[model samples]
Target: MFSLLRSATAFLIATASLAQGYSNPGACSGACWAHDPSIIQRTSDNLYFKFNTGSGIEIATASSLSGPWTLTGYALPSGSKIDLAGNTDLWAPDVHKVGDLYYMYYAVSTSGSQTSAIGLATSSTMDVGSWTDLGATGVASSPSKVYNAIDPNLIAVGSSYYLNFGSFWHDIYQVQMSSDAKTPSGTSVNIEYDATGTHPCEGSYMFYYSGYYYLLWSHGICCGYDTTKPATGDEYKIMMCRSTSATGGFVDQSGVACTSSGGTTLLASHGTTYGPGVFTDSSKGLVLYYHYADTDVGLGDGSYLFGWNVLGWSNGWPTV
Candidate 1:
C-alpha cells in the first residue's frame, strides 16, 4: 500500500507539470481555430493579448505566443445583449487599445440577411462588464439599416483614421474617420468587391507589414447549422493581397490581383483549419489567427475558437 501511494503521487505530479507546460510560450502544439484574431500588446509589460470569436466572445490568452492558455474573460459582459433578441451570432470581435483606452469592434446579425452591421465599444479595462457600445456604422449609423454591415476595424496613420467593413450586400469599403475615431470624415472608398466566390467576402482585417498594407479576408459562406450537415464552400479558406495605399487596389506581391471572386489563398481547409485574420506581432512578426471549421470540438460547424500560427514572407508572398 505504501508503494502504491507513492507511485500515485508521482503520477499526479507529472500530470500537473504537463498541464502547466503551456505556461511558457512555444510549449504547446496544434491549437488552430482562432477566427478574426485581434491582438494587442502592452508595451509597458511586453505581454500580448488575443481577443477573437468563440462562445459569446470567448477569450483565452497566454503569457506569450506559444501558450498553454488561461481563459481570462469574455469580451462581452455576462448578460450583455448583442442583438435585441439575443440571437448570439457574435461573429468577429476586434480588440485594440488606444493609449489608455481599449476599443472593441464586432458584428451582430443572424444568418441569411443583409441586416447585420458592425458595432464599436470602448473600455479602460479587460473585463467584459466595462465596455460600452459606441453604436453601429454602415449606412448613416442606422442600427436597423440592414445593408449587411459588419466586421468594422481600425487603421490609423498619424492623425487620419480609416474604418474598414463589409458583408453580403456588397464589397468591403472604407471611410475616413475624423481622427477622434468617431464620425466619418470623407467619402467611402470601395476596396475589394465580391471576392473570388459566390458568397460576399467578409471578415476584412487590415494591417501594415513588410512596407505594404495587406488586406486579408475570408471568402465563401460561413456558419449555417440549421441543417445537420453544412454545404460545401460554406466555410473553407482565407485569401489575401496587399497595396501601397491604405485603401486598395491591393494586390499580391507577385502582381496577382485581389478582387471580388479572386485573391491568393493564405490558408484553406487543412485538417480542419479555415478563415484567417492577419496581425503583425512586434516580437513574432507576422501571425495568422483563425479557425478550423470541422474540428471535433465544434463538430466542424464553425462554432469557432482561437488558433494561431506564425507567418513568413517567401519570394515576396506571405505564407503560413
Candidate 2:
C-alpha cells in the first residue's frame, strides 16, 4: 500500500508540472485588452487586423501579430440594424475575406439570454469608416428556440461556405450560406455539444488544415467571473474535434464523437493565464490567437487581454 501511494503521488506531481509549462502569450502593447478576438491578416498589405466583441464590434490593427495594437474604431458605428430589446453591445466578430471584399459576422444579444441574432457587415478596407452593416443573416434565436445563436464563425470549404454559431442551449450548430454570403441557405445542423455540467460551449471556429476540417470552440463559463464563476479548471478553455468533411463526422483525438459529448482539450488555464478562449490563425505560421484573463490581474471580464502563441503539430494533432 505504501509503495502504491508513493507512485500515485509522484505521477500527480509530474502531471501538474507538465501542465504549468504552457508558454505565456507573446508580448503585446497598446489596446492589449480584447474579448472574443478574431484575428486575420490582409493579403493586400500583410497588415494584421483583429476584431473583438464590443459596441459595434471593436476594430484594432497592428503591423505584427505581437504588437503595438491601436484601437481604430467600431465596424458599425451606429450599432446593428437588427434591434433586440436591451441589446446595446455586439458580441463575437468573425471576419474573413471572400473575393475582393471582407465580410464580418457578429452577434446581437443581451447577456445570458437566449434572445439573440447574428448580424453581418462588409468592408473593402476593413477600416472603421469603410464597413457597411448588412443587418441580420437570418440566423437567430429566442427564448422559445432550441439553440442560442451567438459566436458567429464562417468557413469556406471548396465552393461551399458554412456559418457555425451557438451557445448554452444546443451548444454549436452549422448552416450553409448562400453564394452572396448574406444569409443561411439551408437548415442548421447541430455539430457539437457538451452534456457535462452546464453544457457550456460557444465561440466555434472552423478551419481546414492538411486534409481534415478542424472545429474548435471555447467550453465552460466565459463571463460572470466575480459572482457565478465555475470551479477551478472549469472556466473557459479551448476544445477541439476534427473531421474529414467540413459539415460533420467530427471526432476527438480519442475517437469520441463530438456530437456525443466528446471533445479534446486544446488549451486551458495554466500558469498566470485563465480562460483561454476563441481562436484565429494568422499568416505567421500556425499561430493560435485568443483572449484570456491574467490571474495576476484577477479573473474577470474587465481584465481580459489579447493572447497568442505559435503552435506545433505532433502526429496529427496540434500541440502548444
Candidate 3:
C-alpha cells in the first residue's frame, strides 16, 4: 500500500506539472516518430531540423517549436560506407556545426554487439542531398575490444575537440578528436560508467554552460520495448554529471565521481513519458529535445515520439 501510495503521488505531481504547461513537451505534429533525436536550428533561416536513428539517419524539419513538422528525408540516402554485416540501419546521430560545415557522427552496428563503429558525414548545407559520407572514424570495437563503440557525440572546447561514445560493456568513454573533428587523435578515456543493472547507458551529449561542462546520457533499458519492457521506473531515464575539465573528473550533484558510476537523475518516467534520450539546444534557452515513448500510444519502440522542454537552472544545476 505504501508503494502504491508513492506511485500515485508521483503520478499526480507529474500530471500537475504537465497541466501547468511547464514540464510537458511542446506540441509536435507531422512525422513525429523518432528515436535518439539530435536537434539543431539552422542559423541562416532559423528552421529546426532533427536528425534521429534510422536506416540512413532520418531527418525532420519544422518552422517553429509548436508546429507541423515534415520528414525531410535521410542524410545519407545510399546508406553508410560501413560494411559490417547487419549494420545497414544507422543509429544514434549527433550533429554539430564546425566552422561553416555541419558534421554528423553516427553509429554502424547491429543491436547487442560489440562489432560496431562510429561513422562521419559532412554537409555544406544540411539539405537532403547535401551530405557526403566520410565512412568510419577509426573509433570502432570488436569482440576483443573492451568497450563497444556507438552513440557518438562531439564537443568542442576552445580549440580542442572530444568525442564521447560507448555503451553496455563500459558505459561511457571519450576520445580526443583532430582539428577537423572527424577522426580520433588520442587514446580512449573512460569518463562515466554505471555498474548497476546490465551497465545500460549510452547516447551521451556534452554541453558547456556557465563555467562547467555537463555530461548527460541515457540510462537503463532503451530498446526491445515492442516485445518486452522494463518495469515502470526501471526503464530509460536521463542522467548527468559535470566537470570543470572536458576530459575527466566528472561528478554528480553530491560530488560523487562519475567514473565510479556516480550519476544524478536528470529526468525519469513521469506521467505518460518513458525512456527519453536528450539533445540540448541553445536556440530556445538551453532546451532539451528528446524522444520518449508515450504510454497512451503503446509500448513499442517504433511508437516513440519527439519531445522538448526549456530547461531551468537552480543552484547551478539544470532542473526539469
What tens-digit string does per-residue lDDT give for candidate 1 at 1-320? 00000000000000112232211112333343355556565555656566665446656656676665566667665423445332354656777666577767677765565666566677786555667766554323234542346667777765577877776556577888776676677877677665334455766777765577777676665553324433444444566777877877787655655654447766655443322355556676665655543343454344554555666677666675
Residue 181 in model 1: lDDT: 70
Q: Write the per-residue lDDT of candidate 3 for residues 48-113, one digit (tens) a residue.
A: 787878788898888875568898889998889988854568988877788899888889988888
Q: Looking at model 2, which ten-residue stretch has the lowest summed lDDT?
A: 1-10
Which tens-of-lDDT digit does each residue in 230-260 have in candidate 2? 6776777788898988899999999999999
| Candidate 1 residue spans exceeding 4 A from truth | 1-35, 54-56, 78-89, 137-147, 195-197, 224-234, 253-257, 272-275, 294-298, 301-303
Candidate 2 wrong stretches, greater than 4 Å: 1-20, 277-283
Kindly report which residue pairs in candidate 2 clash with one another.
none
lDDT of 2 at 23: 78
Off by over 4 Å in 3: 1-22, 277-283
Q: 3 in model 1: Cα distance from truth in Å?
A: 54
The superposed Cα distance between candidate 1 and the true structure at residue 11, in angstroms, equals 37
